[model samples]
Structure formats: structure tokens, C-alpha cells
Target: MKRNIVIATLTAAALATGGTVAAFAAGDDETATQRQSSAGTQVVADRDDADDRADDVNDDADDADDREDDADDRTAVATGDVDVTAAEAIAAALKSVPGTAVSADLDDEDDSGKVVWDVDVLGGDTWHSITIDPATGKVLGSHTEQEDDTAQVRAALKGSSVTAAEAAQAAAAKGAVTSVDLDDDGGSRAWDVETRATGKADQDWQVDLNSGKVTTDRSDDDED
Candidate 1:
């Protein structure tokens, strides 16, 4: 009777402190087992949700990277008429002259109508003109264009950061870059780029070296 009275007093104190007492014997606790199962299920569900979210983020990142890579590819080789790209032509020219490429033009106006990439490189005091096959990307021929005009070309290229390949890429929006030239037209030195399409007339653009900006330039049709 005394032990029962002490237990009742302890129960009363617990209740007064807003505490509830619970006890479950091992191997005989169905309610506790059910609570543990429910908690395990909730944890699994949360982990699965986090994993799904991470997969979605990775997928999005992969898609974005693919799009950027595609854009870069298009910018470099969007011209469908020729297989040899401006960048390739510039690289070929550099291999021959080991200098800075100043101009590259895709020409098909020869007597036999052979398509070739004409690349001009500035090597020290000489300007080298290199010709490469459009289909094979092989160097066909090379010649010295001029030796005295290096000073003029150098002056025009001073403080210029945009290269011939970069100028071609800038103008390769709707078509492939047909020609890129370092020019000082209109008193401002910049790169003059021409893009050619299949059925449309060629378009001209001026690429500024100081800021990598592209703008419409004087077109050949403007003479009319």
C-alpha cells in the first residue's frame, strides 16, 4: 500500500510538470515497431526526393552545356558552302608563316572555279599569302604578298585584340564567314568581315577590336 502511494505521488509530479511517462517491453512493443517503420518510410521518402532533385539539376546543367557547345560550333563553322572553316584556314596559314593572321578569304573565282581558302599572315616584315584546299584543308601554295606594307598593317593592327578567326565568328550569324580583313576604313581601324549565304547576297560587318562589337559595314551593293 505504501509503494503504491509513492508511485501515485511520482505520477502526480510528472503530470504537474507537463511530462508523460511511457514504457515498452522489448519484443512486445507493436506500437513502437509501427512508429519506427513509419519513421523509416518518411526518411526514405525524403532521401528519394533529394536524389530526384539532384538529378533534375544535373540534367538541366547538361542541357545548358550542350546548347552552349552547339552555339559555339555554329559560330565557328556555320558556312555550308565550304568544308574548311575560317579558323582552320587561319591555323593553316599560321603553320606556314608562324605569324599573326590578318586576312582570310574563301575564293572560288579562279579559271577552273576551284574553291580555296586564301589566308594572309604577317610574319615580321613580310606578308605571306597561303592557299589551302577547301575540301581537304591542305596547304596548296604559299607566296609573299608584300614586304613594304607591313608597317601599315602593323599600325592598323596595333592595340587590336580581335583576330581574323574571331572576326569571322562574329559575322557568322546567318551564314558562313567568306572573308575577314584588317582594315582602317573611315579612319577607324577594325576588322571587315563578309558572310555569304547560298541564295542571298553577301553581307558585310565591321568588328571592333577594342570591344568585340559587330556592326553593319559598307556593302558592295551600296555602290548601286
Candidate 2:
């Protein structure tokens, strides 16, 4: 009889997360019955505990969805002068605060008429927006942007042999590299760079992070 009671209690706990209750009852003489009767037996569950467990499961699922949304985010197309490469500006920003650069833009501010390197860096779950002077590599100012999940970003960059700085450096041979962004839409991470030169159309280049090879991307051309 005690054995049956213990089994019923354990069954209740297992069903608590599903918001269901199992009802089980048996007399001492009922144990003499065939084991087939246990098949339909129900076990009691704590209703309140079941609701709480269900809520916790929902919260976990929502958190996972939020992280996935952040993982596929894209940055704006940024332009800058070739006098200071994107790699140099990023290097300058990291010197001010140690972190990884996820995205960067060379902006010619319309209101201030000043060109600066605006970089987004990720450190743990925190994000920082840093500005640097393109000409002198001076730290202009910086502030906390927001929080982000670094799990996906870290995994994507694990196998990348070429850093963003190296990709920009390799693109210099093609033209004045303006922007260098990390891209992994094709299942592998690569640095996408933009460049412009006199009497030539603005060109987009991709630096294979694994092989360190520079190639022209015609996708942008197809859009035009």
C-alpha cells in the first residue's frame, strides 16, 4: 500500500508542469487486483504549482525568441573618407574601452559638419556607442547604448580567422575603403567593405574572413 502511495505522489510532481492533476486511490485489498487497473489510475497534482511552472516555461520561450531577433539585426550603410580606414577607427575606439566591435559607421554629420567614426561595441550583455576622430584617432566621446545577447555573435565569430580590421586593410588595395561590417547571411561570417575612388562607381567588397581573400560583391549592383 505504501509503495502505491509513493508512486502516486511522484506522478503528481511530474504532471505539475503541465497544469494537470492525476487522481489515484486504492484500498489495501485493492492491491490484490490486477496490475491492469493501474493503467487508468490518476495522480493528484498541486494546481498552484502547475500554473507557476507553466508561466516559467513561457517566460523562457519568450527570452529565447528575443535573443533570436537580436541575432539577425542589420546595420545601416555607412560612408567615410579613405584617409582613415574603418579598421583604424575601430582600433582607436577599442583603446578607449576594451570590447568587440560588432558594427561601425563613418558619418559625415549634417548638422555639425564633422566626420566621425561611430562604432557599436559589445561587452558581455552591454552595448556601447563610441565616437572617434578619423584624422587623429582621438576618442571623441562614448556612452552606453543598450543591452544585447552576445551568444549568437560570439558563436558566429568563433571560426573567423580575419578580424574586421584585417578585412578593411585588405580592401584598401581595391579603393578607399569606407565601411567594414560583419556579415554572415550566407552561413559564414565575412567582412563587407565599401570603397569609392574618383571617376569610378562606388564598389562593395567582401573579405573572406577564413581565407583572407578579397572579392567583389555584385549583390548591391543587382539592386541598382
Candidate 3:
């Protein structure tokens, strides 16, 4: 009876040891699987972050390229076969002419492919209409009007009783006097003066030469 009891106790001990070993092995396998899953998740997240960064860099590069393209387009539009700097240079050159006021007008082309600037100038007795080439700064054409005479212009002055000499002096104070003419309208004599000012806005004067009185003075306004 004693031997059987000892044998039964040993058998129970062996069974318990085997069960513990099996449980430990199963736990180890589960832990290893969980670790592999976590590592895989981290790798995928890293890859996604890298891709996002790369996309941002590509977007920035694309934006830079677009800006460069826009700048190139603007440069092309501003400058053609005719140099814009040259046009400005021509305008500057015209400002140096004596008894010539020069103003820039809308640039237009003629049949000869020349760009012209319409300038208004005041001479002793008339308003001189002038056209100049923007590229060459050369006078293309100029004309004087009889109605722009200074003596007649002085008669038209705003003041009630200003002399022709005073009107002429006033106009001259503002610009360069090119010529002065006398016109006799029956008993009334008028003086016509033409002048040129800087920046070319019109400054001619007309006055009564006989009485030294201004009969008509049109300085600021130009008829032609």
C-alpha cells in the first residue's frame, strides 16, 4: 500500500510540471506575435510620414516654378522689339529743345512703323501742334495756328485790363517765347506770341499791341 501511494504522488508531480511548461511556451509565442504586429505598424507610419514630407517639398518646388513662369511672362509683355528704355530716353532728349514744351501722349504707329508723340507747344502768337518720334526724339511735324496769336490771346485774358506786354511777360515767365506777331483787327491791334515750356502743356499769349492792352489771352487752353 505504501509503494502505490508514492507512485501516485510522483505521477501527479510530473503532470503538473508538463502543464506549466506548455502554458509558458504558449505565452512566449503570443508575446512574439504581438511584438511583430507593433513593429509593422510603426514601419508603416514612418513610411507615410516620409511620403507626406516628400509631397510638401514637391509642392513648394512647383510653386517656385510657377512664380518664375509668371515673372518671365511679365518681362516679355513689358519689352518688345522697341526698347522701353529707349522710348524714355527719347522723351528726356526732347525736354532739352529750346522754346519747345514736350508732353508724352498715346504712342501710335504710322504706316512707316514709327511711333509718334503728340506734343502741344505755345509760340508767340499760336499754339504749335507737334509730333515727335519716340525712338529718335526727332520732330516729325509741327504746325502753328493763327488763332493762337498772342495779341488776340491777350485780349482774351482773364483780367479786365492787362497790357499786351504784361500778358507776354506772364506767358514768357512760364515758358520760352518763340515768336511775337501783330494783327490789326480794324481799329484794334493784337499781339500774338508763341512760347515753349517744359513738360509741354501749352502757354501762348495774345494781347492788344496798339493800346498795350490784352484783348484776348489764351495761355493755358489750346484750340489746336
Which prediction has the highest TM-score against the true structure? 1
Compose the digit string of candidate 2's lDDT tens values, residues 84-203: 567888888788878888767676543255666777787667788888777677888999965544676777678678877788889888866667887856574678888766457668
TM-score for each model: 0.59, 0.58, 0.34
Candidate 1 per-residue lDDT, tens place, 1-224, comes to 99999999999998765533333244347778989999999999999999999999999998986666434334334444368878788887788779889889876434244557889888877778899876678899998875666777888888788888887877778477778898865587788887766556657888887776998876555776
Ranking by lDDT: 1, 2, 3
Model 1 local distance difference test score: 0.76
Model 3 global lDDT (CA atoms, 0 to 1): 0.51
lDDT digits (tens) for residues 87-203 of candidate 3 = 243243345433323223323334233445455444444566566554455666766655434554445432435333344454455454433444434444455655544446434
How many collisions per candidate? 0, 6, 40
Residue 23 of model 3: what lDDT? 93
TM-score of 1: 0.59
Candidate 2 colliding pairs: 22-42, 22-43, 22-44, 23-42, 23-43, 24-42
lDDT of 2 at 65: 61
Instruction: Name the 10 consecutive residues with the lowest summed lDDT in model 1.
Output: 19-28
